[model samples]
Structure formats: structure tokens, C-alpha cells
Target: MTQLTDPSGQPPYLRIVAGIRRRIMDGELSPGDRVPSTRQIAKEWGVALATATKALTTLRLEGLVEARPRTGTVVAETAPARPPRRPSPPASPSEQELTLERIVRTAIDIADAEGLSALSMRGVAARLGVAAMSPYRYVPSKDDLVLLMADAAFGDETYPADAPQGWRSRIELGARTLWAVYRRHPWLAQLGSLTRPLLVPNLMVHGEWMLSALDGHGLDPTTLFDIHVLIYSHIQGLAVHLEWEAHAEAATGQSEDQWMDSRADVLRELVDSGRFPTFAKVVGAFDDGYDLRLDALFESGLKALLDGLAPIVES
Candidate 1:
């Protein structure tokens, strides 16, 4: 039976899992069917978003639900009934050979897979099969752990020691490389602002690349660094949305497209009200709704930014 409440005194998330699991097993929710979103689950069950998220995470770990990029979480087509991801406790802690490298890598994996906010030292220890406080031996705290994680993430890609001829090409290479890192580690953008930037050595390699490219372009030191900061800001600004979108999906249990679609009625009312003639005209011409491809947007904006900078380089 679908559990309306946790009469068995199980945790709220477990109760959610039981109710959803029952629904799935009884063939009520077929393959690829839209499941109740996190918001809907929270509302119906009177639980917080995190609890609802945990329930969904449990389902995903069990291979029951899978998150689709453009679609929200849905029933897996041929999901195997399996246990959730909490592994067996270690028989001997020494067998795992835990080290600072392992600790940072595990932290990175968690940040990369889930997100920065989802990360906790205890969680890293759990994944590493060690005592909850074991990670404290190597990385003292979550803040320091994140710094190391960001350093490792930034170090993943490197530029050639040999120079590309033009400043534009070099700048493009640097921007794209940094973009790839951010794309790989979306959580990286969430840390530090332009004013209070991430000062780790690995991250400075990218700044060095940008600064080197702008060096001989007749611009003074301030102007050169200004241009560098502008380029960096462009990438960071757009990249922040990557994490935001991911969190939004987890919280609302709606994909970007789904969320936009849900808001269509409101948008149509605003558009048809004739207050936005230019907006309506531009939007009305699309036969198919716009696809918000962040990669394409990144590339397009990069080109425009370079085009504007080309004049400065030439002068």
C-alpha cells in the first residue's frame, strides 16, 4: 500500500521512498512516467525540500529514477531493484590507505556529482569508508578542503608553454580552457567573487595566461588586467548559472524547459498585453521555442567579446 504517513516510525525520507517505491512496484507509475517532483512531494508529505531531495536521491541511488538533462527526474525505463549507495562499513580502516589525495579526490567527486552545498566532511569520510572524523586528519575543515578541491580542479587542464601567435587566439584558448574546467566543475564558479578571488596557484595559471596574452597590446598594466578581469568575469558570470540551474532542478524537480513551460501562460499574458511590442515580435517569430544551450551561448558571447577586444589589440 502507498504510505500516506510513516506509521512504522521510519525517517520521513524513508517513508517517501516507501510510498514511491510501492507506487513504482505496483505498476502504477510506468516507465518514463513523470514522478511527483520534489516540491509536490514536500507539499503532500509536509516535509522540507532537503528531505524530499533525499528521498529522490535514494530512489536514484537505488536505480529507480534517473535525472534527464532537459527533462526532470523520471522513472527509469528498466530499473533494477537494488539497494541505495551507503556501502558496507570498513572491516579495517587501514586497508583503504586513506590519504590527503584520496580525501581531496573524494571531496571533488562529491562536489562534481552532486554540488558544493551537498558536500560535507562527514559525507567524504563515509564515501572513503573511514571514521566520520578521519578526514580531519588531512584536511582540517570544509573551507580548506574546498580550496584544495578547487586547486585540483583548476590543475586538470594546462596551456602549452609555446605561444600561439595572436593575442586573440591565445585569449580564446585560455577562455575556452577555463570554461571547460568550469563546465567540468560547475561548483567552482560558486566560490569567491572577482574582488575576493580564488588565490590558489592552479587558478593563477589561467590568469597568467590571460595576462600574458594582453601584455604587448600597448595597454598599460591597469588596462591589461582590466581586460583580463573582464574576460574572466564573462566566463564566471555565465558559469554561475550552471550550478544555479542544477540546484533549481533538484529543488523544484523540474528541468529548465519544464520550468519555462510552466511559466508560459504568464509570459503569454505579458507578451499579448502589448506593453512589450519588440519582445512579442521577436518571440513570436520562433516556430519552435528557444533552446537555451549554455555552450552555444558561451561560444557566441566569447566571439563578441573577442571581436570588441580585437580593435584594442590592433591599436
Candidate 2:
């Protein structure tokens, strides 16, 4: 039993489990033979001893191995016997057992893998393997679906009911949580234009929480609500680029770097020609190349915005 090279870089526990499973199925490790001791497995597989132990535990749980007192862990006697496989549960219609709740979840998955722009009622129905008109039972129109999706994503997260020690702390937490939700579903940022505002209760709850955070700042209710929308816009405007980048890559099968490389010569020549000295100088500041770190950009931009708003709060 020599250590095998793992190409996928799977976690050591999974690799170790995979190794043992391969040997058992190959009949190299016979049924009822004493399986390797955790120490022996550790040495042979070059994995940590704890990982080897967990591998054995997984095998035991799967009924492929067992521990016998005074005999150490051995392959289970029933290892070769095939267990009955459970049948998959049947799918239900969107109206029969299907609800708006279930339809929204499926839509979320589509937006998660593909960008939100890729989402359509027909696409969602195709995913459910149902007729295109079927989703209309749960969502009246594509606009309604988008609204439901936004609310669904917003609802998945819980806000801290207890206020932080300070307003700034409270504001930062809410902004960061909202940022995270958008990153999880990048299409969410595009939904913030206030065109009817989705009318979803969960998003309204999020807005309410933000308004409450600013209660003591002396801003009028309208001003406070406007400020919250402005904050959301700032974060979402930058985040929309993330969705664009994703969509571009998926459509063209080109990464950001690859896209830049394709246009590198033309861009470099244009900047270096001295037609735009300030643009050239600024672009040169990033010789190492610019990679978007969404979390860092969100934090820095939010902090700057908050700093700018401090005087407004005091006034």
C-alpha cells in the first residue's frame, strides 16, 4: 500500500478515505482482513495520523469496516454484500405541492451559477423540467420573479436584533452583511434601482433596520431613508461590475486577465503616446496589474463613504 499522488488536492481525510475504498473494491484488501491500523495507514499514505483515523471512521460509518475487540479494526464481513439504494423522492408541480418559496430557491441556484441577467422564467421552468408557463403559477411575471429572488436572498440572512455599542458599529455590520449577500448572488446589485422596489417584506425589513440604526443621528425620517438608499447604491454600483465581469467571462470564456491581455498592446500604446499624461501616470501606478478583491474594495469604499457622512451626522 504505497502513497498515491492526489491530483485534485482533495482534503487529506477524503484522499485517505478514497485510498481505502479503492483497495477494498479492488480486492487488494480482502473482506474480513484486518484493515491497516491508523498508525500503519498514516505511515503508508503519508497523511497525518488524525486524518488516517478519520478515514477509518468514515469506512466504519459506510459499513465497509468495523472494529473487533482484541483484533483491531477489520474489514466488515458484510463489506461485499450490496446494500439497497434508496429511491429518489418524486418532483411535484409548482402549484400542486410547489410554492413560491420553492420556486425562489430554484431561481437562486440559477443566479448563483449563472449571473442574474441569465435568469428568465423560461430558464427557471426548464431547470424544473416543467413547461415554461408553469412558473407563472408561482411568479406572475419576470419582474415579479426578480423581486421574489431579491427578497429571498435578503431573507436568507438574519440581522443582529441587538444594536451595537455605537451607530457606526451598527452601520458597518449591516453594510458588511448586505455586501456579503450580494457577493453570494452578484445579480442582487442590479436589482437596487428602486423601480417599484420589489415590494418584498424581507428587503423592506432590511431597510427598516438601516433606518433604525440612524435614529439617534437627528436626521429626519426621509433624510435617513434617503441616506440608506444612497449607501446601498454605492455598494451595489461597485458590485454590479462583479456581475459584469462574471457574465463577460462566462460568455466569452475569457478571464479578466485574458481580456486585458487581448487588448494589452493597443491600451499600452494609447496610454504611452502622451495623449493623456494623467491617465498614463495613473495607469502606471499599477504595474503589477489590478486584480479585483471584492471584500477589500467594499470595506475601503464603505469606510470612505462613512467618513464623508460623519459631518452630516453631527450637523
Candidate topping TM-score: 1
lDDT values of the candidates? 0.86, 0.74
CA shift of 220, model 1, Å: 0.6
C-alpha positional error of residue 191 in candidate 1 after TM-score superposition, expressed in Å: 0.4
Candidate 2 residue lDDT tens string, 136-242: 98778988888878888988777865778876787888888778778788888777675455567887877777777888888987888778887878777778887
Q: What's the CA RMSD for each of the models?
A: 4.4, 14.3
Candidate 1, residues 1-315: lDDT per residue as tens digits?
233565654568878887898888888887798788888898888887767877887888688988775567899987765434555654447676888998999899888767899899998987777899988999889999999999999999999989799899999999999999999999999998999999999999999999988897789898888889999999999999999987887777667888998999998999999999999999999886777888998999999998998888789
TM-score for model 2? 0.66
The reply for model 1, stretches above 4 Å from the true place, is 1-92
